[model samples]
Target chain A: MSSPVNPDFLILAVQFVVAFAIAIVSLVGYRMFGSRTLFRMALSFFLIGGGILVQDAGNIATELAGFGPELSILGLVLEALGYFVLAISHIYTVRSEVGAEVSSMTLLLPFFAAAVQPSTALVLEGVARSVSFFLLLYILSENIIFLVKNRNAEALLPIVGFALLLASLFIRLFFVLPTETSDLVDLLKLAGFLILSGPVLVLLVRLRGGPP
Target chain B: MMIVSDILKVVKEEGSKGEGARISSLLRKANLPYNRLTEITDRMVSNGLLEVTPQERGSIYRITPKGEEVLDSLIKFEEFAKAFGLRL
Candidate 1:
């Protein structure tokens, strides 16, 4: 008899497709705009998407080939690193006195923490993801206030986009949805990214008319 | 440091009057010295972000369509920066 298809795999496939789309849009915008901010945003999306792909691959391997759990942990680590890179990008853009004094130990702390306690790797990964989400929320909130104070209408799009993302993250962190409805969170995340992608793509279309 | 976005803003605002701005007016509005404005405008012209018209009095600078597009992008960039509490 043929084996039943795993629903988790289907959900993962959807996530991969959405994440890849976001990464492509970000990268294209970066290439068209040629700005350091766009470059960092592109890198952040690419790394995050790549991390998801790695996790999906690990899941398939484990389910089909009985692979060890290390691959899964490694995937989580990659995702965490992607989030960290995103936070760093925000810091680079906002801070004027950025120093090249990053410590090796600081870089390795997450990996070491995961390695020393493999069982808690998932928790550690969750913590890292939460940190990124919180940072994003803080940034978005600040921007929303500034836009409000300045009376800029352009703020609406990003405000809606980031709000959806923040809601999704909040749901993921605090509430456990029923197993059958869990994919709702992923769908919400996808919607948030789609919202964010729209403006970037519009900008890309405008930029393409100009000299490269 | 003055970013390209800020420079583009000055050009776009100056060109908004539709008559095209003179070099002196651009320098005054952009808060850039003569040398810096000249250099930036030259680069912008080469990048297709600005167009230059030589007149009997002096050179006139106007923002091209591409320049407007860049200004739009810069506005978005400013929004992005503000999200991080940075003023661009």
Candidate 2:
């Protein structure tokens, strides 16, 4: 008999698809614009996709092959790295002086990661979670400042999206909600991803006017 | 990006039937300084976004199909960024 499907897989897979599409567009945008911000965006999205892929793989392997959660931990590590890449690169691009930030991240992330872990993977995952939470907060603030200065209505979409992502991360990192509530959190994160994908989605549609 | 797209648009508009647009005409219409124009065109040529044909004292430029695609993509990209209130 065929085994039952994991409903969670569908959500995670959709996340991976969205993240991968963004990564591809960012890669094209980076090539076209030759901008550091675009490069950072592409790299971060790729990392997000990687994290999702690894996390999904771990789940499947555990169910089918009876493997451990090490792979999932690695996914968390990658997810955290992705979030940091976006935050740090944005700061470096805009400010051009990133030494202090780098030094602090280097010193602090390891300690944070060490807080709860029996193995290397778990340690890395812990660090990753901490890094994701803090970096997301940092990025969200930057978006808010941009919105304040520009007062551009369109900018609010990303701001709201980033805020939702931060909230979801906060909940995931701190609180263990019930199963039904966890699904709601997943939907919240998915909505955030969709909002951030807005610009690229429109671009893709506009790009269709060109000759094939 | 807009400037580059403008250059491509000019070449595509003026260059047709294999005649190609002369450097002088491109310079006049594109409104870019001589050095900047040549630099941009040369890069475009190297990138295969524009084709250069030799003429007396200078070369004519024509936008390739790739150039058209890039121009279209860049235009869409600019609009996309603007929609998000992002500066490219």
Candidate 3:
């Protein structure tokens, strides 16, 4: 007598859970290390996780279905800001100050793009692609270095996942609104995030004081 | 912060003995330069994570209880970072 489960909602659930889990662990990293890098990363993950749900809000909630375009745009903005923070975390070089300058400088752009002008959505989308692509590349480079130094075959998971995500980003530069292209992007990111989560699981255990 | 944790770890390891650890010995064990060690030590002393006892030869450093707590957090964080394929 039970109805079938919706796969979209299921995927959204998994993404939400994983993103928030990583965000929580990274927040703990910020607390322990007192580094702006971890703080920004935590903020980015939180935004990305929340953005996933909000972007698909219409899909999940029947009443909100009519607000799809606006909600989706807002979600994109949130996700874009998430990418912005993530890229800043990777590339930011200023260390040892109170971090007021860094915080003010890095966070302003996404807030404006997200809140000020709807017309900027395209720009915001493009910027999101750039930042996330760069972020993946940076992490991939770090992963490669780690592998070379430690001979860790484990590093390949995130590397491959990030590579797929990177390829999707590259594809997006050409086909922005194609249904199949977006679907491929979604598939790649899901696979990427799942694989990347394996490494983060170790971090989560360390953060929680469990045996690693 | 990583340096602070590293210094605390070294001090705790080396200075847990009588009268704590001397600066020269700390320099050798901590792998940090002299001026940097002293500067960070001074700050750690001020922050209450470390305490100093003045002696005729020089000041000796020891880890405080607060330093132990901070060291725990920092070590866990460092391990987490390592797991995530980072040096810091």
Candidate 4:
């Protein structure tokens, strides 16, 4: 009966769907075709759990508690690893594209450190959480450079998803605070989340025909 | 990239050392139950992992230098596993 365009609410919905798709893909792919690397599988589970937890925390804080202050630090930590996994997925695309191999050793260090040390894990998680933002920024800058050099709207589509991801991260990082953050910041965060997650899912479907 | 194990799997099961069967015939003879011989040969060539040389008589099939290195590594892994009392 209700329309789904209330910005923050829409972002939450899209994030949930993206998270769900990621979980399914990770589960099925690892179970079927993947190398069955224990560490990487664990990482995938961590990210999926983090995504679910973040969504849950946001819901509890916003609707039930009305008192928002770190209801789910565990979720935050998991969310960090989730983004890191997503980053790894993007990196792995290089395997298909260039036929290059990254040593399994290179993949293990960051995850092992993230798992054993909480404080260090927190810092790493924070950095990893910021990845989509940086990727969006990179895409934006690159698109601008390309537009100036060659002027193509097609160069901008990939950045659409990156922008949405940046928006959601910006909200989590700067806006979703106690009671004093700006309404404008909150608005931007919600808008960014919806744009990044939902449109990116569509783009990925069209471009990759499924989740990466 | 194909692993050494995969290559050795091919070589060991499909290896044949007979004259009069040209390298092409040897390649045709070297297929597993489920392999695509042509694609495998293309891969073998691209990776510098297999070679065929034409002699006065007929072409000879030989593992390339790098292919030999890979085969040697696979053999070493096999020996190490055996020494460690592990079976796979």
Question: DockQ for model 3?
Answer: 0.34
Candidate 4 retains true contacts at a fraction of 0.00
**Per-residue lDDT for A146 in model 1?**
54
The number of the candidate with the highest DockQ is: 3
Off by over 4 Å in 3: A1-5, A58-64, A93-131, A142-157, A171-185, A207-212, B16-20, B25-39, B46-48, B64-66, B82-88
The residue pairs found clashing in candidate 1 are: none
Model 1 iRMS: 5.3
- Candidate 3 chain A, poorest ten consecutive residues by summed lDDT: A89-98
Interface RMSD of each: 5.3, 4.4, 3.5, 19.7
Model 4 chain A — which ten-residue stretch has the worst lDDT?
A32-41
CA lDDT for candidate 1: 0.63
- Candidate 3 per-residue C-alpha lDDT over B2-31 given as tens digits, one digit per residue, 9 for 90 to 100: 677767877888865666778888788778
Candidate 2 clashing pairs, residues 3+ apart or interchain? A113-A127
lDDT of each: 0.63, 0.75, 0.68, 0.46
Candidate 1 lDDT tens digits, A16-101: 56556655655654676665555656566676667667777777877778773566656655655665555555455445533412
lDDT, residue A57, model 1: 76
Where does candidate 4 stray beyond 4 Å? A1-11, A22-52, A58-71, A95-155, A167-189, A196-212, B1-88
lDDT tens digits, residue span A28-91, model 2: 9889767555677779889988998898888787778888488887787787778777766556
Error of 2 at A209 (Å): 3.8
True contacts kept of each: 0.09, 0.31, 0.29, 0.00
Candidate 2 has a DockQ of: 0.22
Candidate 1 CAPRI classification by DockQ? incorrect
TM-score of chain A of 2: 0.83
> lDDT by residue for model 4 over A169-201, one digit each (tens)?
677555446534444554554454344344224
